[model samples]
Target: MAFDGTCVACLVHELKEQLLNGRIAKIAQPETDELLLTIKSTSGQKRLCISASASLPLIYLTDSNKPSPMTAPNFCMLLRKHISNGRIVDIYQPKLERIIHFTIEHLDELGDLCKKDLIVEIMGKHSNIIFCNENGMIIDSIKHVSAQMSSVREVLPGRDYFVPDTMEKSDPLSVSESDFIELLIKRNMTLAKSLYTSFTGVSPVAAEEICTLSGIDSYLSPKELSGDTFKHLYNQFTIYFSAVKEGRFSPAIYYDGKEPKEFSALPLTHFGGYTRKEFSSISEVLETYYASKNTITRIRQKSADLRHIVQTALDRNKKKYDLQLKQLKDTENRDKYKVYGELLHTYGYNLEPGAKKLEALNYYTNEMITIPLDHTKTPQENAQRYFDKYNKQKRTFEALSKLIQETQDDITYLESISNALDIALTEDDLAEIKEELINAGYMRRKFTKKKIKIKNKPLHYISSDGFHMYVGKNNLQNDELTFHFAVGNDWWFHAKGTPGSHVVVKTEGQELPDRTFEEAGRLAAYYSKARGSEKVEIDYIEKKHVKKPNGGKPGFVVYYTNYSLMIDSDISQIQELS
Candidate 1:
């Protein structure tokens, strides 16, 4: 679920309990769209982060502090001057909308206690943190929205502050069953759309959950539902809303395998097949889910250039490979042409001049065959022409075979680089990959005189059996780990016939346990493109037997003798060395 009205309501409930009488101690604007407020309550000091980022609008309690600028912004200064020491009189959500109103009691210039409302709206692009008087007139906002910016409402100072009721949605907590059924019937859209359009703060995920709970197809229109079905659906809505009203919030994140799919302020029974991880507070759930999501998002953003380069090259090479394969197939008849020339020379010694055709016996197949000849040339001349044609095609076949092999190698190298980017967690990892691309001639080197000093290293993990296993993140690391770092007795592991990391288990002149071997194989599979597979085939060989061919691509190796194993790609239980 999104950080919808229900999520905000949960946060409001938590805030009302934890920070009802808290006094504002400090305030700061660390980013253009974010505000950090420190409040001193009866328990202790607490940090509340309010962000109105157009991409990710969020509000949550955090323990971390962001560094503020040397000079404060005008809005931050205004907040400090007006409500730096204001007591939080009340905190509430408005009709299940994605908005929170914090009513603060503050002392005015005349020493009289006055009330003010600091509103935080969590709408996507229209999100804002606004300061207003008790009369609901906006004093200022973190983001100034003028008449030109929005036709719905203006968030500038002196503007009337109100929750823009553009949707005209009813409060789900108070709506009757008949009204719910009627609202659904009024909408011609799907059942999911009707649920969100008819009620405030119910996201598509929540709507889908309602439909799933009621045993109705979310894609089906409300007009298709029977009266009994509508009643059952409304009953499910009441039960879901009752949990919200009764404060039975279960902050949880649903995971598809190892990746977080979605999070909700309440238990999502519809996500039964997915892994559900519940936290004690909604803040924790939001923080954990977003932190993981942000890390993955940032890595993808950083690796976009690398991915584009690899994918473009891969496509070109694959096309070239296909064309080369066709040319090679065309040359498959070169052997037949050679046999034709030989048979024609033997069978046409006494033929008439410019013989158009000849009958010959195929010595290999022991069968009679017909050979066509050029009418303008003599029998011997026609045989020589056939030989020349055969030689040309034979040369083509040889050249194309090598070209095809090289093209395949190019595709494999790019794919390995792509797989490396998937596991690249730091800028150092990306730097190493970029350097490898430069060295491999995929990317041109800049005109800088100084050489790059690489700081990235292989991932080191201690197996369950206490054997040290190292996994390379990219081709450069793979070469370094296998050739320079590992000893002759050390074991090397790789995903069989695929682009993957080179994994090395340090034997220390001692034999490795079965569990260590399995762990190392798992690492090889997890870092490869086959990470999502149920089981990946891995080949393991001693470092002495695994040899890199001269003039071959980086991380490319040949091992005639090796042990193979099928292992799953889960390495979560393996402990890594810092």
Candidate 2:
């Protein structure tokens, strides 16, 4: 979900309650587009994080602190010089806009009392944090926006700081029922579209919720609605905003299985089927949602180079493997050449002089066959020529068979590396994968005087039946968990004929329950390359039955006997230990 106007309002309410009279204790710029401000309020010291990132703009109160650079940025220095130790006079949001205003009071250079506004606009792409004087003149901004960037508003220093009037949206807090219906009826758009477009803070999801509450179709245009339906919609809209007006917010994140799907300032009836995890404050909701999203996004960004390397190698190996198979297919007729040579040796003496061909009965099949003859060559030479052709093809077949197997193995190893990348969640996981690639000669090993050690562990989970389960994140971890970690009596599970994590369940010499097996199977399926499939076929056996070849690649094993089960890739019910 977007950091919509309703979310902004909830944040403003929470901030006012926490930091209305707080003193600016410290200021730091940990990133180019972010700021961390420590404020000493009546409650306690709290850190407020505000980011104007073009991709993910956010403002939330967090307990965690980020390390700053040795030197402060220009914007941070300017802010510290002007508003250092300033008292937060008031904190408020303007109408339903996605903006927050922090009015600070402090003594100026002349020892006279003064006020300033630190405004944070949460607009996507155009988001900015501007410091303004009492007269609303921009002093400086975290990001400088020129006239060329946005003609509607320029956020450079000394420019007039005002909210852009391009939206021309009405404040939902004061919008009357008659005005709501009349304004919406003029627009030739869907009911949901008109609500968000007509009001300052109503988002598309919130508009849908209103329509659901009023028993109206959000897709229907306001112009097509009957008078009775419009009245009902207006009634529901007022009731919905009443929570915002009264500062009654229910912050929650809805989850689709284990993944966060959407977050809302108020309970969304439309998402009733989803698992809603409520929070005591809006900041908690924003922090949790964005933190989870950022972790996944950051890991992907960091793993891009590794992914590119793995994919390139995989593609090259796959093409080579295909060509090798085609070449191996051509060697199938080598046996036919051998038969021709044997037939020639038996019947060459019977050929006439200057004969172009020889017809002989193939004793093996009792069938007549014609053999082409080099007329200039003697019968002995012709027979030797056929024998030479057969010997060359026989040698070619032998070489190609070995080459094809090696190429096929290379393709498999590269694919497993690719799958490992897909499941990588941290830099440590990536480091382990990179080590594997370097060891396999796919990547060049870096020469360093001091060796850097990476400690990466497999995922641990507790099944419903109190059984301990472990899932490998990458090939290296898979090998460690399957061999060194598990005893002979422990159970092992893996996705059948696919690149995936090896799942191990420690039995401790007790009988296994069906529930534990199913849970472990889900983990094996979820961490594997076949994740998100409706059902995955899994092969399971005792650790004693799973044997790694003496020179096999990491995670490669042979199991002659195992049980197979079809299980889904859902691990939401499984409890994982961090």
Candidate 3:
């Protein structure tokens, strides 16, 4: 959520609850811009990870620890020298800004007690971890910014440390209703935009939530709102922030079918359609959300080469298929040539010598027709020449018809591979896909002394009616699930006429319920290429009715008799087995 001020406030609240009066046990610098601090509080030992990365700045408590570098960085050593064993006296956020101040009391070089401020600013690219003396003079910062870097403020030693007030936003925690309405009314923008731009900690999502709670349109400008509507919005806004002030947070991650869409420290009622998975703490929310996001991003990056290979082959086959279809169209006139030969043979004897053309009646259509003849050749020879031309085109048509089907098959197979890449979630999935490509002759097989083992498995889910449903992640797995794993009485499902996973419901010789069928259909639609469509057509039949053609590609099957269902790709209600 952009690491907005509200999130900072949430983290600060969590830190105060866990780390107040805690003694710093250990300090480690795993990355140049990151620090892992071990603290001993009343509850237990906790690890606090703080990162001032330019791209992703974060501060959260985590159970996982990272390997530290052999030599400490200058910033890490400086922090350890002064505040290594310091007691955290206080922890607070400044006026709802995206900044946290940790007051630490430690003994000076002469054994005298002194306090220092370890400030963590969660601003986007300007994020920094600064160590300051009691009087707010910067001792050193993890990141150094000179005057040339930023004209607003320089984060260097001996500089007075302060939070930049460039945005000039009001503190939502302290602002009154009159001030809120007056500030919002002055901005000529949408209500949602006005709220975030006017307040320090209000994000766009938070603003939208406030508008939703107040039954007001967030798209409307402040000028369009009546006085009573403004009062209602302000009331909702106060109620929203009061939770933060009172530490009544409900941390959750909202998901759209298994993918995390958004996270919030407070409940986001506007996103009621999403699947909400609440966490006991905001730290869990941050860890799970970012970990899932990183997995998705990493898999995508790893599959780029496979995607390119599949796409290149698909494009080539598609172009070849188009050309073959056009060539086949030209052979459509082969029958006309045959008719011309017959007409010439029937009326050739009556033609005058050196005649350029012969006019005759066609017996096939019982109509008058014209046939061109060679002036130097006899009529019989001309007829024979036409017969040869007809034979050649007939042969061409037959060859092109067979070639066109093969080209079409190649195109479909390549498209299925592309779809497989889309649904691949791990390295093993990609390895299986790469092996398929190598076997299909689209890629060269890399030789190795030892065979690599692939542990990829089909996605398993339990239907609402206590039935088991299995979804194939790739063509190999699809073939295995349908032909080998499922029994004759099992139900088979797939997206109609599209590249998708094969869903098999193990009925165990029992008649399936209607709800099980619908749930299985949803799984088929969700795992297929047409995942986001509102309604997808699914074909279902018994495993005995589904047949795989001899010498056909993997995952290719045909069923003559099957039932069809039009269902959506939403599988949020379905329970998946990990």
Candidate 4:
């Protein structure tokens, strides 16, 4: 499914059909690697996307538009000067190599009708977009290739332009059976490996497709086939080769269950249809899946110290609260202890002057504390000291009890905030969570200037069945997605025990389906740190049950009555926005 030679061929065919006789209406560069050209034809208007990026070079008809920069790049301005209102003359592919050329006829500043060429080369690591004049003299390139970039070609202004030779490459559409067998044996590799590695135009997916058509194991060694077996294999190969010549192609995204494996052999998709190019590459799949993994890693690192602090505070608070409660309960017997000590001191005088024998008394305070008596001391002096000791102990208990309660409340507050952060889905949600820390005196508040406004949109995915699923990337977006966009009956999903994006499946009043549930699980898992794990637990429920708590951190919510399932976080299963 990667942007293979076949995709380049498709681009040539499309441009020939739509842009060859059309007039260029507008041009813009949406990204560094890409260009968008709006053309007007007798049929209607068409926008063509062209890219010469090493990683994702592509050319296709696209309906989606992007915001253009205020000032056009010099290259863009130059293209507009020479090619604006130009009529495309022809679309040509240089043999079967990864290059396409669009020749345009237009008037120059002197009003002479002249020819110009736009060449897009999509060879990985050597990809470039070159503009040349009528005589094939290089004008400039999107990327200037010098001796340092590539010795094979130098793309600079005023340089002569020519296509490089690729003699070792075999065109699968034109190869004879004898030539194929000889090449296969010469490569000394497996059939699939030879087909994939020896050819300049074929993708691994295409190699696999050829093997599938041949009814042979792609992994089988080239030397393993017998003469008769080779004959049968050649016959099958010829059939597929004829199909290629006839332009019989089917485009389907291959998947291992819920994950996208590749995209090729297609019933062609047009603009506004599912954009296979978005998930056509294995690298794209890896990037999306691992981005969520890195997010989880960052969250764990950020919260590690905070988690420990909360745990220690909680333990100390619990211990102090328990001790304080016990001390306060002892207050019931405080007066009793004081009365007993006083009675002993007062009654000592009656027993004998300066006598030490303690006598029992009816203590008004409930439980009693025994008092030590001295034979030499007067009763009044002992009684006075006893009262003072009782008052001091009582006051200390009251103060400790109030302080302990305050500590318990602080622990409770911190614990709640920690729980909210543990479920934060995006960096914006983390920002709101950190604000809580600042207000609670755990973080310092610097007089930071407010940030400039930028619109944040939800990450959107279109399901295989054509349902639109929206994932909120931050708490604000989550709130908007769930409370604003989601209907009561729409399904909501999130990763269990992990902070993740809110995934909403817009049911549009349709009954819930199993595939939809699985797709939602993939979204939930892919948006969480658990995305890289082989499997993750996902919780799902109706949108109605998901409630944003009052005064809670962004992306924080409480929901009950949900079901859970285990799923692999592989986004290779879901279709991403192009």
Candidate 5:
């Protein structure tokens, strides 16, 4: 998680094995702080990406290539001039620090072999890629840091290159058992903090891992630890670093449920109960972990406005719906008013002129009732006034009932769109939703300059029984998939009484296996608003039985008869097709 000195140690070990003696074939700078190097090694051609970005510094071997700028940056040109055809003599890490030094032997402009050091520092804010001569004098850097920007050290050309020791942390590889104990006992910090602060490369997570290995509480004060506890901690710490020295790295990513929590270059026994995905290389681990994280981050950024739009509309509709319900409730007295009018109409002839109130027997309830009246108006006029109130309330109830239903429909539509946004994995998926929103009049159509043809399609899956299943991503896809893509014999599934994707399993002119039907139901439930619920009720029927209403909203359908199943919304076993 820290991407600290230990990770750098692992990377250097890997680079030394894969890239040592490799000839630099080509170098390209695809971004302001990124470089892609193509190298010819004894094994094969390898592409190495190194980034000095302040936000997300990374170094990994990748098979994919990035598009370079039309004009190379000065740093890119400089590296090309110096090390274009250089041979990598050695790759090493300095004192277990978060830095990598690549020693390159190349011919200078004078046609004489010269050596240069290409240093990549992966420190958080102070990260940089620097090229220096054999004398350790900086030639140039990807990012120029001066005394003005940082009082700690300057990274300008011709400055003597050296790793900063501002933190005064001891190198873990050199710290003796006695030194480690003395250092921790003297510190007033917590156990976790003392480890990270006193030793290089020990992150908080790594510190906690040591505690777990020693069977000790990380919150306990180091000074308060007993003699046996101290010995256990030291033993565990030594064992952990011993693997790094011997290159016994077991790269893996820890997961909390389905979410990636952290990755390490060594086994994280502290995460024994959690899910662990082991990788062959740390580069593979970083690439897989970050790529998934980046996709989610990018999609969230792209769908932020859509989420806001949907949520706002949802709130408005809910308010309107509640107000309508209240108005509908107000009409409850309409029947009483009607009864009063009827009683007055029948008993009006017995009423005295100028009476303030009328006392009459309510025949319906068989009870005496007192009804207020207008003294100046005749009994007939009073009865007519009561009749008008009844009529107005009755009319209000009818209109409100219809409006309430419409408002509820709008709320449901918005929730479905929000769920679609959550399921969206690509920009194309978002485009489909945006189009749906624009068509629904919930958002103004933008005057976009670039017209990316919408090719968003339904998610296709193969059930455990080998039946092809199609799940709609949004309402538009749902309608098209059910009405056009599916055949009459195909089985359809949906989450009962909830907004969800329509799932259709192609029967292939044969009866569907029970397992296929269950998988389709699971897909329907997983893609719907009821996802993750203990048991989601799913309705399944033949495609022919699911009829779309005339002039209905997208994906709205009617079905009088359908089989139902309560099942978990787990589709991890289903095979997905691109």
Candidate 6:
């Protein structure tokens, strides 16, 4: 997960734009380093995600993603005690320095209105989630930055705090063209490198985008820029700043084919062809991608043994078939030899039947051999016995042929089912697929006769355009959605060639708008194990082509001629169903 400071900036901007005046409805710390803030915005309730993890620290507004632990972590409990029901008074970013401050107003122990400042510094290793009193006295923090850790300032209790200094750099959002050029020249680097490194809060990618818009090479030396060139660059930078203020988010994922790719946008060229997606914010990207990945991982963890069981059965059967095939081949040689023996006995008198000094001609290979058989038996009797031997050998071949065919068929069937599992999306879908394995004797059935209590169907989301989308939780639910619930015109989607749940978008005979398709694709991609991947391939097709074989595993199906899209594994755009 690329939980960079840029992602944190995007989240802060989103909260200020879409959820500025929203009240803090609920707060929960589901993990040691994570917080889920449920806010009641004018549009609807939204969940904002914040984390101060040593591995990954970022703050983003997420629509749908799995919470970390079922039990609350200690940090979460501490946060709930200090900040519950705290109304957000203000949300501000500190000059694009990868930090966001939320001024929350609440009643103190004496029931008087008190204000607390929650500062989120998203500076990678320096990231901290701090809670302070109105006087800037540190109350508690997700992480404590002691004096020993940093020369700047301590984040311990009772310390008077202030935001970190940006040293000598001018704020990119407000600096004059001459100042910008002066800072760039002092850096003595490429235009892309200079702007990102010199400016307070200017990401390398965003800086390069400015150069791109101005028709200037990002690799050009900053010292080579003329006065007019500097002015042109500044104007382009301003355009982007204004665009961000207007909420124009270009959500994207960079990858090399099937694997996720990561790079700092500071060197824009390194982030090649980062396809802009249909998402509105970074949180949407995190939610969809991570949630899908979580589901896939969970199912894989749960069904690890079932997969092993089926594979073991397959290996055992394959070996049996190989041995039987070899035996059949050897029997053919034995039968032919027996026939040769009988022929030699019957035709011995015509050749050199019992004469040790004479060799008889071999009928099959034209080799000469001395025939020693019953002396009283005529050549005619021996010939009749050879014919009988030939007939018996042919019968054995016929018997073994049927057995070999059955074993090969079994191998083919089991392999097909395993391939279907690779594309399963949800645990329920896996459950359905597992049933098929059990029924075929590849696995043992545990819930043979117990009545299964059906939970409510997976959460449903209605798009802004009013299209209904249904997400399946497991294979049994997938079967229900595709076969019994969905209409013919409904669109079906799944993570291409991976285990994931089926996502169905009901058009209701209504033609799907393009946004709806992208949104649905994002959901499908997000719900698979590949969700955090740079690009998760999604398979989309009309509901009509999907079919479950009789007694097939749950969520297993056969379909062809589907459209595929490479999408980022984030589903933050669609509002989750309550």
Poorly placed runs, candidate 1 (over 4 Å):
10-95, 99-166, 172-198, 202-281, 445-454, 575-578
Cα lDDT, model 3, residue 308: 90
Q: For model 3, give the 10-residue run with minimal summed lDDT.
A: 291-300
User: What is the TM-score of each predicted model, taking all chains together?
Assistant: 0.70, 0.85, 0.72, 0.57, 0.76, 0.50
Candidates sorted by lDDT, best first: 2, 3, 5, 1, 4, 6
Instruction: For candidate 6, report its TM-score.
Output: 0.50
lDDT of 2 by residue, 235-330 (tens): 888899999999999999999988999999998999989999999999999999899666676678679998999888888888888887888787
Root-mean-square deviation of every model? 7.0, 3.9, 6.6, 11.7, 5.8, 10.8
Alpha-carbon shift of residue 233 in model 6 (angstroms) = 2.1
Tens-digit lDDT string for candidate 6 (1-578):
34444455566666777677677777777555567888887889888877766545656676655545556766566667666777787888776667788988877788988888888876666778888888989988878778798888888988987876646666766778778777888887898878778776666666666788788999999889888888888787777666545545566555555444433322344355663233555666665555555456556655677678768878988999998888788666545546555655645555544433325566778887654444545555555565666677667678778888878767655654554456555555566667667666667766536555424466588776888888775555667888899878789998877767788998878898888888888888776657689888889999998877775555778887899988886666577776
- Against the true structure, candidate 3 reaches a TM-score of 0.72
Model 4 global lDDT (CA atoms, 0 to 1): 0.72
Q: How many clashes does each candidate structure show, in the order listed?
A: 0, 0, 0, 10, 0, 23
lDDT of 4 by residue, 328-422 (tens): 77776677558856686656556666665465655564444445656676677667666777887789777977787676656555555555456
Question: Model 4, residue 146: what's the lDDT?
Answer: 85
- Which candidate number would show the highest TM-score if scored against the true structure? 2
In model 2, the worst 10-residue window by lDDT is 292-301
Better of 2 and 3 by TM-score: 2
Work out candidate 1's RMSD over C-alphas.
7.0
Selected candidate, larger lDDT, 3 vs 6:
3
Q: Per-residue alpha-carbon lDDT of model 5 for 1-578, expressed as tens digits?
A: 88878888888888988999999999999878889999999999999999887767889888888779778999999999999989999899888889899999999999999999999999876789999999999999999999999888899999999877998888887788889899899889889889989898888888888888888888889989988888889888999999888998888899887778899998778888879998888888878888865556657877999999999999999988888899899999999889889999989888989998999999999999999999999999999999999999999999998899888888887888888898888788998999999999988887868676997789999988888999999889999999999999999999999889999999999988789888998999999999999899999989999998887778788999999999999887788998
Residue 13 error for model 5, in Å? 4.3
Residues 258-340 of candidate 1 have per-residue lDDT tens digits of: 77899998777789999999888888877787875554655676789888888888999999999999889999888888888
